[model samples]
Target: MASRSVLGDIRRDLEAYVGSKIRLRANKGRKKIVEREGVLEGTYPNIFTVRLSEADSVRRVSYSYADLLTETVELVVCTASGKETKFEAHSR
Candidate 1:
């Protein structure tokens, strides 16, 4: 299972990937935005899915790899209601 800290790392990496102004959502309720590129890669079992884009100011970025069986990263954004919104980063 992927640890919660992994999400933090991904968030931190987003800032670097998209530059230094990328805003990532902190947990739920609070939407964090940054003007940066989001590059994410992972192994089997542990995938990431991006669910929400906070305020819609962020441009959706996509990429693909030839290693993992799953194409997209599964990022679940927790909402203020303590619910999760699941999203997948797949190649089209």
Candidate 2:
């Protein structure tokens, strides 16, 4: 299990990417994986929000730092130059 400090670090890292484009893959258990593209909305103490647009409908989604710390959520930041970089967790 990840420690509280790890979660804090995750939140700090994500806060830097606020307002950037990103792709995320989240494990929903039972072999289900949800993937989407969105703009990093904001990062809070416990969770971060993303602004997503699908089929002309816009919605927001939130995920906790614990999700990233545990690898339940995989985030890849997209750059304006069309580059993609996966989020790296803090080494144990």
Candidate 3:
């Protein structure tokens, strides 16, 4: 229950970054790391989506907030003034 509360709070904070540019880094097992820059498209009760585009193709990836809580995903929001706000999983 506590973990859910923490995730809820984190989700609310992330909601403010919608439509903003953000850097997303995730682990794909076997020490592989994938990183991408995209706009925080939208946030739902259980998951959020990020829209990424390369060349002429665009894609949207959805990840659950629980993924953040488990350190599966890391997010960094880039601000207009060159400041970055990072969000990572925290030990509970």
Identify the leading candidate in terms of lDDT.
2
For every model shown, what is its TM-score relative to the native structure? 0.23, 0.91, 0.88
lDDT of 2 at 61: 91
Candidate number with the higher lDDT (2 or 3): 2
Q: Candidate 3: TM-score? A: 0.88
How much is the lDDT of residue 81 in candidate 1?
61
Tens digits of lDDT, candidate 1, 1-92:
33445544444433332221222322222453333323233222233322224466644443222211142223333344656444332223
TM-score, candidate 2, is 0.91
Point to the candidate with the largest TM-score.
Answer: 2
lDDT per residue for candidate 3 within 1-92, as digits (tens), equals 34777878878988888999999998889999999999999999889999998879999999988888877899999999999989765645
Whichever of 1 and 3 has more TM-score, that candidate is 3
Off by over 4 Å in 2: none
Is 1 or 2 the stronger prediction by lDDT? 2
